[model samples]
Target: MDHLETWEQKGYVQFPGFLSETETNDLKEWVEQISSWPPDPEKWMHHFEQIGPIARPARTEYIIDFHDGLRRLLTTGKVPETAGSLLGQPVVLYKEKINYKYPGGGGYAAHQDAPAYEFVKLHITCSIAIHDATPENGCLYFAPELHREGLIHLNDQGCIEESKAKSLNWEPIPMKAGDALFFSSYAPHYSPSNQTDQSRRTLYLTYNALAEGDLRESYYADKRQAFADAEKTGDQRMRVSKIGHFNGKPPEQS
Candidate 1:
């Protein structure tokens, strides 16, 4: 089946080596630079951690707002074309971020992307592999076509409940450098903890219908304010976005 067909059938599509080797190398260089950026409390670059049954160190994240290469990658690059083809319409960028899951980094909870993006009704995301992602190192697994059901019961963590998630059929998506995975915002997806010693960094670029109007700037502005307010109240964790939530307890191994 063609890409659009795959998207229609799976609620997600994978484009392997969409970028040429040279382009991929260049992007890797850019990732190196971006990853080295110094942390600033005034900026949105941040880290999170977890410990318990799943132990992990801080995972890093930063919004892509002003990077020229990154902007070009999402706008004039293959990301939008791939996403637009799946969407059957022109798509404009909504937001982008890199989840730098280092060794021992905990996994995200199973959650749909739509609920976190309230500024727009429809959104699609493209995840570009910056490094090889293996099941041993936190590659994403998706519940195929469950997105057609829309939002499901959310647990206290603001993610899909454990019981419902257990009922869905999830398939793992392992990727090599330069591979891209596109999925609807409603798709239920999650990644496992990075058990390997290496890092697994993926750049997630989200877009909405061009007709929805570009809300990227305002969206980040609002997030900055929201997080800033949350910081002031000593309750930041509760207000943090659900992008990386771990849906429920890990299933017991028999």
Candidate 2:
């Protein structure tokens, strides 16, 4: 589908229906089943309360089980082939997360992905729409060609306000379920408030060169105690393997 060429020219590529009808439905069902309750509903709600009024009752969290499903898709060679063409190597899946924005959910402020990694050029991100994303549904907006400008310092709020003010000149990329949007991690982008009645679901995955250093250390450290607790409970080794996939690296053998 000449994804690399398209992305190179436009700074973003949208492949419609990248997932088949069956595949999309399967993923939706899995999310609904596994996400029936938040990992810590009470604590989650309290955090929102502390933050003041939430635009909507939105849920944000990581799903480890979904990694197997997404990995299967990555290995299928469709998504990875396009990424490899852009990255110039066999890309490694670095992380995955699900963003479910409910009606009236406030939009995320414009920002660059690489800033979180200290602005490394080797980072890339793929955002797969699990449902149709329309303007009203808060589809992503990006500033094309802005990546060439290199890193713009973010303010104390962790946002590049100046760059985002200029980003208004850039275009928004609206996509639908089964469609995927791939862009450089340095690109400036954001989503709008979800004014629609339905939830806006997106599966976001990041890929980086294997030589990009151990990039998932923070993620593993945050969940290290959880892993220890799981081990004590005698969880199946397969479950541990699934958790390890997102842990950045395996623990050292004693």
Model 1 steric clash pairs: 109-245, 109-246, 109-247
Across residues 129-218, which tens digit of lDDT does each residue of candidate 1 receive?
A: 989999999999999977788888887666888899888788999999999889988889888988998878888888999989998887
Candidate 2 matches the true fold with a TM-score of: 0.73
Model 1 lDDT on a 0 to 1 scale: 0.76
Model 2 per-residue lDDT tens digits across residues 198-218: 978887777777666545544
Most accurate candidate by lDDT: 1
Error of 2 at 180 (Å): 0.5
Q: Give the lDDT of residue 207 in candidate 1.
A: 91
Model 2 stretches with alpha carbons more than 4 Å out: 37-61, 65-67, 74-76, 118-121, 162-167, 217-219, 222-254
For candidate 1, the 10 contiguous residues with the lowest summed lDDT are 244-253
Per-prediction tally of clashes: 3, 1
